[model samples]
Target: MTSSAPSTRIASKLGLSDRIFAGPRSRRLLSTVEAGLERVDAALVRELAMADSLANATSRYLYDAGGKRVRPMLALLTCQLGDGATDKVIDGATALEMTHLGSLYHDDVMDAADKRRGVPAAHEVWGNNIAILTGDLLFSRASQIMARHGEAAIRLQADTFERLVIGQMHETTGAQDDDDPVEFYLRVLADKTGSLISAAARTGLTFSNGPAELEGALTVFGEKVGVAFQLLDDVIDLSADPDETGKVPGTDLRAGVPTMPYLLLAQRSDTSATALRERIDDGVAQIADGADPELLDDALAELRDHESTQATLDLAHRWSAESIDALAPLPDGAVRDALTRFARAVVDRSR
Candidate 1:
């Protein structure tokens, strides 16, 4: 704590949800959050440290580079519903972040991404085998930390990991001929991205002994927010700025990964879209053969202007709105309003 914790504070009295804008209680709670986040950051570094030199370097790479820390934030935020950021909540938040960082390693390897967080991807620097091992190590460490929190934490971590794997698998295999690509991709978003976020929210409630009734609503809310977040990412990929996004625009197309905008384009039989899709397919092939990602520039530029990009944006907004609706069970107050803002803010990035 920047300021030492009180002997104890009544969780409900903090009134963090409704008074976020102004009030002595709001300022106190904000300080508590700042202190909690700082502790989370430090704990992540300590957890990533290892006795083995190679493992230490690889495992710590992206965690050190930095992230939005959204999952950890949600963990801490929901804890306010109960006892606030207890030591257990902080540890759970740190573990939640590690779970996310671990997935990045596997994602980079699958996408053949060259960089992450403004640095070379682990696979790029250390080769895929080493990178994959490092990711596994992170997951293992997260599990070990969860062990401290008992069975519920362990179970949550396991369930999230299962969904993460399923989502990645579906993304990798792609939609079958009979499957709806848009729906498939949304499901991918749910499992791959949403599941972990949902678990993070659950961690706060489960670990902090928050209201039992809010669990279902929070779970749905987290998943929808996750889907919305990824849908926005689909738009972001086509309009990437290296300095801002840490990856070039068209990285997904170049890597031949399917995206919502591209999927929308594929569904159309329009002469113009069909022509553009063919060209993108050609560029993606070049990338698969080790060609420059910039080769996709022209097509991605076209995609940015295409109606499909707008369609994707609209889809994101819909999901975001739905996430807010899921907060219905939450008492109508600052907490629910704050979460609504959070849902909007999550998908509003780069808009």
Candidate 2:
């Protein structure tokens, strides 16, 4: 189905959790997230302006384009749901968002992306070097913010940052050779996508001093949801409409990133498999003309049918179940329910 299509009925049976997408809980959490995102945008604007006037203007230009700000919101809501009512979470959220933006700025330069969030990328507005410097500055500022807190918070943020860097390095270094397996993809995803999520949830538990059991459970939940999220991203990268995805289709294809769909398909087809390895080593054009579309479709179908996707779903579901059960021993309230649903929603989101 196209990206904007109201998800296929089949996804429901696949155990894609929807508990977080229903009722007043979802609405309230969404409203809270919106408010939190606005605050984050304002902070980004203020900090980007910390540069000289020209740099400030360029930063503002990047800020105006807008984004989902999902990481920060996840950090904030998880903290609140865990009964941690400190403004420190907001500070943490801002730091996380800044770090995320910094990564995107650098990623845009590396990817040679011209636009993001419907506007020119940082590298497009400023030169690549300037964008890289700005990203560095943002990352440094994030650590500074985290450092204002006690050692525990500082250590947590530091660990999360390490994971983020490791994930990026792994992605850049890993060869998409024939020897690479789907498990490698999962590891890459866990670090790249899961680290921030794990940090967000763990921050909540830490702030609240929630049960120790909840920490591992929520971490698992975040990691599983993160994997599913990235898997869907890889899927959408191949199939999503340009308008919805805010980028060109076939990005992974062009980049020679052997995403899950293609990897799964390669496992089953000799010619397709050989073409995949060739595409990784050379380029997608190596595939015979008219083969690209068929191969992409077959890969997508294989992804849909593969045990890997189900395994991803199972992991996500297990975490959701654990997150809910972990909360069962806590006080019954809207916040707890909202938190539970939020975890459920993490895996259910289409975009």
RMSD of each candidate?
Answer: 5.2, 7.1
Model 2 Cα shift for residue 77 (angstroms)? 1.9
The residue pairs that clash in candidate 2, if any, are none
Candidate 1 clashing pairs?
17-334, 18-334
Q: What C-alpha lDDT, on a 0 to 100 scale, does residue 242 get in candidate 2?
A: 60
Q: Give a tens-digit lDDT track for model 2, residues 69-138.
A: 6666566556655555356776777777777777887777766555676666788778899888888877
Candidate no. 1 TM-score: 0.91
lDDT of 1 by residue, 1-351 (tens): 022222112122222333332444334455566667778887887888889989988988887666777787677778888888888998898898898999999999999887887788999899999999999999999999999988988988898999999999999999999999999889999999999899888777777889999999999999999999889988887774775567777676788898999999999999999999999999988777888778889889999889999999999999999998999888755456656777886677763
Residue 142 displacement in candidate 1 (angstroms): 0.3
How badly does each model clash, as a count of residue pairs?
Answer: 2, 0
Cα error, residue 242 of model 1, in Å, equals 1.4
